[model samples]
Target: MKRRNSIWMIILVVLMTISLIGCGTTQSNLENKEAPKPTDKVTIGFSISTLNNPFFVTLKEGAEKAATEAGAELLVVDARDNTAKQISDIEDLIQKKVSVILINPTDSAAVVSAVESANKANIPVITVDRASNGGTVVSHIASDNVKGGSMAADYILKTLGNKGNLVELQGIAGTSAARDRGQGFHNVVDGKDGVKVVASQPADFDRAKGLKVMENILQGNKDIKAVFAHNDEMALGALSAIQAAGKSDIMVVGFDATDDAVKAVKEGKMAATVAQKPDLIGKTSLETALKVANGEKVDSSIPVELELVTK
Candidate 1:
């Protein structure tokens, strides 16, 4: 009877042990089902000319948001409009093994070596609103600046009745937008007999420089009929300078269609401004970047349309 009792006790303990083990596994399974979400570990790098301009600030925000949405880390570095600094920034990001790189080149042609290095490292590059000397990047996204520029010139020339002495304020010397817009305007103005380009100078796309430069031009030239500023900030500066100089006869054209540009157009402070949809550029760029990083086919080129605003 004692032996029978011992056997029964052994069976009971074994059954209890099995029951506890099964319960522990079931609990573990439930806990695992409620485990924390897995996050993707991907990093992207962005190097812009500078955040000194509001347009670039918006662009950064778009890129950051897009990266976060796709569960990636975005590393942004501002080169303060310096070519060497920009190249170094890109190299630093590359060393960190950033999966992708987006650069807004300070000097369009100077970033080529950095791009080639990225290619050798098997990393892809996306250029935003600028192009290198060689087509070394996977994609280039920007507005149709040449067309926008042409529109500005056309509007100015047509409104002035095809006869005006115009002075153009250019942007940063080597940037693609600066070159394209200035040349695009020249394309229209230089061909016309009635339109005379008086004096053109680089203002480095600064509002204060535009004001000072315009003031000098206004003082030096009495027959100034119009001004084409490469950017709205410069245009606004020129408008202020004109008001100060008591030069009310000159019509002013500007680019970038920034909020101030649009407001100036509404106020008739500027004759016309070419508007580039900067926000849309950011949005499309981020979308394309995600596609590129995910091994999906993306558009090699995305062109943002430009509009001319006049009041």
Candidate 2:
């Protein structure tokens, strides 16, 4: 609003800050009024289950970068892993007239009604890293979790020499990742004669629970040779429990190439971890959301490739 020598221009990015990149107009050459025109605040909603986990944190970073570059406002709400809260957050975003909605759901089935409500408000919805069993979300971007699970299984087989007792540390009990990863591991281990799953327990994707569950499993069966954890946090926690128990016979493998998991892999503490590339997942989701919001055709699902990192 103030045209001082420093040039103070007002841009109303309501919910979040926007960084404008002047590509078509040269700010140095054109007159102040004719130079880079500011874009109106186009608030896009992001409903994240929680900001506590590293994966979700990285996803938020990527989404923020994309939103800033596009001169769009980002309104992020935390559900704190509650389905009801997630639904309310979406409803609030819709009431605020956010241009689009990006949901990293707390529960696939529970979020269906919220997505439907957003749709009724003429707001496009996009799912990131998880899918709803119902509702018409415009686009979905998530890692090929089943394939990542297979990769971990392959690592376990190779590490255990294809014939050893194993344990599975599941993520959040009902999440898609936990189910798919379990299926992938079982498919491989069930076929092998001596490679039996001695224990399979749910850790709820938390390091503390992983430690506790692993501790219990260790007391019951000390002969386990390898463990496949559905997520990096769980795997790392299991690794710590193994160390605390003074056991060196267990081979630990984790999905999600989180920093801790990578360190463990490098130190030979964990056999391998799958790299999901959360930054890419976030960027792709927003770009896809933009397309869907503009009435352009976008794929229902874009699968993220997985990479195995092991030493």
Candidate 3:
């Protein structure tokens, strides 16, 4: 009876060991299932509004550099500033099942449906240099355009000595950057009793349009003392018109200190321009997208710093 009991006890110990080994395997599998490995491949999609502008070109380059550093694949599609094209590009990226998407919207309100499509696909979306009107976005990365606008206005005020007739050149009508910048400029300029806005028109952020608009405004308003363009392109266009008209006394303030704009500032052609870090915005957007892909939490609004560039 004692020998039989000893044999049974040994068998019982073997059974317990096997049971523990099975439990260990199950727990290991569960842990592996719960977490993704860091080495998992990541693919990011970029939908640019237009590469025609040098600013956007720089932004794309920055995103590409960041993607290369992270060992991630970047698929860039240019909308050429077409809202429909942008929406279609986003849908394509969704069908490609990219890990994340970065969009620079051509029109703030028009891109809502496209953004929603990305949401439905469970792909994270980040906006660079612009924002979408309605959609679930992980984060928005851009300069504080309103503040930059105010900065331009303040500079104009100081340059004009608190009293002048000003002309406002607007950007694309539906864009948030255009709206916010115009608001900021008006916020300060409107309240001043001495300064008056002679003419405000949308140049669609185009240099040629800015020139033509300024020429028309000049034809009607000869007393205009200064011009504030929503962007450097328009500002440069306005500058050309002013120069051709032999109006050397007019002060021009612009936003987005692009290379040409900065050169103009240095050469005393333009009064000042609000500097936006387009490269940083692009870099941050890609980095943030990677974090979101990794299931990390991020702020809904991310603002890049702005500076007033002057000669």
Measured by lDDT, the strongest candidate is 3
Error of 1 at 245 (Å): 0.4
* Model 2 alpha-carbon drift over 4 Å, by segment: 1-41
- Compose the digit string of candidate 2's lDDT tens values, residues 106-213: 777788999999878889888888787788877788998878888888888876778888999988755666777888778777878778889989998888999999
Model 3 misses residue 255 by how many Å?
A: 0.8
RMSD to native, candidate 1: 3.1
Q: What is the C-alpha lDDT profile of model 1 across 1-311, one tens digit per residue?
A: 99999999999999999999999999999988976778667778889988887678777887787767778788899999889999999999999988788888888888888888888898889999877766468788998778877898899888888997999999898899899998788888896887898889988888999999999988888999899988887888899999998888789999887787788779877888887777777767777777788888767778988888788
Query: Each model's TM-score, in the order given?
Result: 0.87, 0.85, 0.87
Who is ahead in lDDT, 1 or 2?
1
Off by over 4 Å in 3: 1-39
lDDT value for model 1: 0.85
Off by over 4 Å in 1: 1-38, 68-72
- Model 3, 181-295: lDDT tens digits are 9999999999688999989999988899999999999999989889999999999999999999999899999988889999999999999999997888889989999999999
